[model samples]
Target: MKILKINEEISIKRSVDNGTEEQRVVVKSIIERVRQDGDEALKAFTEKFDGISLVNIAVTEEEKREAYKEIDDDLLAIIQEAASNIRSFHEKQLHPSWMTTDENGTILGQKVTPLDSVGLYVPGGTAAYPSSVLMNVLPAKVAGVERIVITSPPDKKTGKLPAAVLVAAQEAGAEEIYKVGGAQAIAALAYGTETIAPVDKITGPGNIFVALAKREVFGDVDIDMIAGPSEIAVLADDTARPDEVAADLLSQAEHDIFACSVLVTPSEALAKAVAAEVEKQLLTLPRQNIASQSIENFGAIYVTDTMEEAIDTINRLAPEHLEIVTDNPMELLGKIRHAGAIFIGRNSPEPVGDYFAGPNHVLPTNGTARFSSPLNVEDFQKKSSIVFYSEKALKENGEKIAAFARLEGLEAHARAIEIRLRK
Candidate 1:
């Protein structure tokens, strides 16, 4: 891991950022093929890349109904608990459509409308992410998204998605499920197939190709985010435990070699101790090589002048996960301005946000927290501003609107307003 001293504010911005050129090229190619060939291309690519024979491209209703029977009741209980928590958190984000009326007889309001269909891609093959299903779909359910369709590759051995994933999908309320994955899955969702209906929006995480496909199909359909590798930034002080700090950093690193993990602190002693603890913990981890490579390539440690300086550096990194493991974490909450998800204090960690915690785990990566947001119910819904007017309302504002349009040289627009007012 590279150790850089970030005693000044200027050094933080330049020192902690990454560029995303490699992801774009891969995404573009996958998008073009899917757009041209449609279903035939999807079947061919699934066989070539995933090595699964094409018996069927869609999972049946029987499979979804049997999903609950396959799940262990105890585990099903936990899934229910998690789903309830996620629903509770997202329910608070819901907005009701409304209108207002004035004595002037003008009616105006905004309407909240769910997208006609949303395509959710769950990462499949050897990796099963049940938590992702709950995170992605619960918000959409709460928001009353009209249709939520899911796609995942079946296990070659079992010809089914993981039981946990299936249960989560059923519990969180997916309207349809398909047996497909990767860039082809994204393409099917974006462009539509004989089996899969094209969605208005697509949201989920996948490999570089999948991320790229989401980016590639962006104009055709809206995507949640062009996510990069996962990232975590932990801010520690003397009060923070070295083992906890080291463990938290390694948690994100274990995701992949390109994943990022970092620790920033005002305490030089804590930095040295955490560095040693990381080495000790890494040897015992099952994913040692993955974690170690990630630490070697993208991991970092920065010693800052004060806790405030550390917060400034964390803001500069704008990581996917931020943990404020400091003396008074709540004190720093007001200080933090950017991050996909902020897990406050020593007890809170990224995994909490990943699974049991109610917050959506699909977060902005690659310093995108500076502008983007975590996936939520808001992502599944669309808003349209409604304007109504009686003749009185139109006449009251008509002259001012027409004058502004005339000044901008939009004569036709001005005439539209002027004609209304004159009548």
Candidate 2:
């Protein structure tokens, strides 16, 4: 694949960054109809979309315990370690409910509480993503979500979920498992059926159908960000290794044919070297075609005038994953105002965030990082601001409060406070 030349003055538009245009709509409509029609609609979609018979949507207790033994100890250990790292990182993010009493005898603060029930979608189709299983459940578990329900499609060939996925879910503390996928699974999670209970919120990554379903079901249940194709941007200098940067770019590109992998560097020589390294690495990757298409269509090397210029260009992109492989990445951290997550140094690759690293892999994409954030403990929990007033407190500020309410034409609100003060 030829390296696309990016001009320093221009921001290159990815040929494939078409945002939320696909199956999100069709998936959404299917989910709604399934919510209304229940088993009938769900089975039809399951058969049509997934090509699976659906007599039982919920995984049985016996089947779950059996899945544990089916997976070997080595893979199990990896899942356990990943879960531990994820748990430890999210534990630091926990917030406690706090209250304060002011001079006027008024109490005000916020109560941080976890959701009662959360639904996690573990994408299962051609391949199983145990990493996604870890990503979705770990945050909710850390947030103290009471009941975590997991759903993934059964394997088309084996007619069962991959051993790695089931084991990962078990390690992550999912309370229940469902044998469903695509838009139908989303519908069941949102509306509940005889077998599956409705959850308070749904979180995870899926195809365009799942993304669209999440978009359509937003008000009915809380959702994480509408995820796009995985993306990574490596900001490197002449000091950075060309081979490593090329490998990192391909890592995200292989995620999907549309995934965007980019490199922005101040050194033209380094850019050329990395571009050559990308070609060398692609020959060895199993998903070479997918990664090649992604890089050829959406990838590029932007030669900036300086490191400062490179950082400015990256901030505008707000990529899902950002890696700074310059000499001293720490000094450049504050300069980076955007990015869903930042990895500094040559050793800190994007996959570190994907698995063993404590930070979440599920992140905002397509420049949404400027406004949104990676899935964290906070996403599975909510905060309600607390307010309380004593008779003395109300009397102290009653007139002002009443005047403000009156200005807004809320006579009842003014009367309520005024009546309390009068007493």
Candidate 3:
């Protein structure tokens, strides 16, 4: 990790989305083929990218039962517990359709409606992330989404969905599960095939190919966000523990070679200690190759002249995950303007939010925290504005409404209001 002094200004260059010209072209071809050929295109692409041919694209009831059997009782119980927590948290975020009526017979409000259907893409080639299944599915379920579909790549070794992924999806109340993955599955979800139905929106993280596919198919079907590599920025002070900060940094770094882990502190001693601690801990990680590469390339420690400077630098970066290890972490909360999720104090590690903390772990990455947010129930729902006016009210405001519409050169709009008034 590089150590640098934060002078009058903060300049930390972050990595952008992973997209190559070749990947985009390949993904485009895959989407077009899926759109034109339908089920056959899905089968062909499954074989080509996932190295498995499937007679059925959907996961059957029998497969789900088998998956449950494969999972341990303890793990199932844990997943259920996590689901309960997630449900409780997201339930609070659920908003009801509301309207207000005035004595003059005017009604104004918003109609909150859940999406008819949603598609979740869980990555499943190397290791299955059961946690992701819970994080993505539970929110839609809480939002009252009627249909939730899951698409994950089948294991090459067994040609079956990972037992954990299946169990989690079932527990999270997924209406349908399909044995497919990559950009092809995204295309299938966007434009339905003979086997799978189209969805109103798609949400999840994937490889560069999946990211680009979502970008291409965004307008056709809504997408959560074009996520990039994982990142974490720890804002620590002298009172913070060096070992703990280092461990948190590596947690995100291990995600991928492009994942970033940074530390901003006002104490030079703490910065040096964290830098040393990170190097020592990197040796023991199973994903050391990936983490070390990430740390070497994108990781750094910035020593600021003051705590305010550190806070400013953190806001400038607008990291996906921000861990505040200051003596009074809460005191800094009001000062933080940009961060996908904040982990305050020593007990609140980044993984707490990632797994059991009841907050959505699917957050904005690649400095997108500046403007975006974590995936939640709102992502799976849409709202429509409601407007009503009595004849008396329209008569009272008719001229003003017509004038406002006419100001924009919308004579049709003005005449529509004028007609109601005249009536």
Task: Name the top lDDT candidate.
Answer: 3
- The local distance difference test score of each candidate is 0.85, 0.85, 0.91
Q: Residue 171, candidate 3: how far off, in angstroms? A: 0.6
Question: How close to the true structure is residue 370 of candidate 3, measured as C-alpha lDDT?
Answer: 85
- Provide TM-scores for the models: 0.93, 0.95, 0.97
The CA lDDT at 381 in model 2 is 91
Looking at model 3, report the run of 10 residues with the lowest lDDT sum.
9-18
| Root mean square deviation (Cα) for candidate 3 | 1.3
Tens-place lDDT per residue, model 1, 1-423, is 666797444221222222257656655666668778777777777788777777677777777778889889999999999999999999998888999998888998989998888989898887689998999899988888878999988786776788788889988988588878887889889888787779999998887677767777888899998777788899889999999999999999999888888899999999999999999999999999999999998888898888888888988888889999988899888988888899988778889889998988999888778998888878988999998888998888888888899999999999998887776
Clash totals for all candidate models: 0, 1, 0
lDDT string, candidate 2, 194-300, tens digits? 77889999999887677777777889998887777888999998899999999999999898888888898889999899989999999999999999999888888
Off by over 4 Å in 3: 7-18
Cα displacement (Å) at residue 161, model 2: 0.9
Clashes of 3: 0
Instruction: Rank candidates by TM-score, best first.
Output: 3, 2, 1
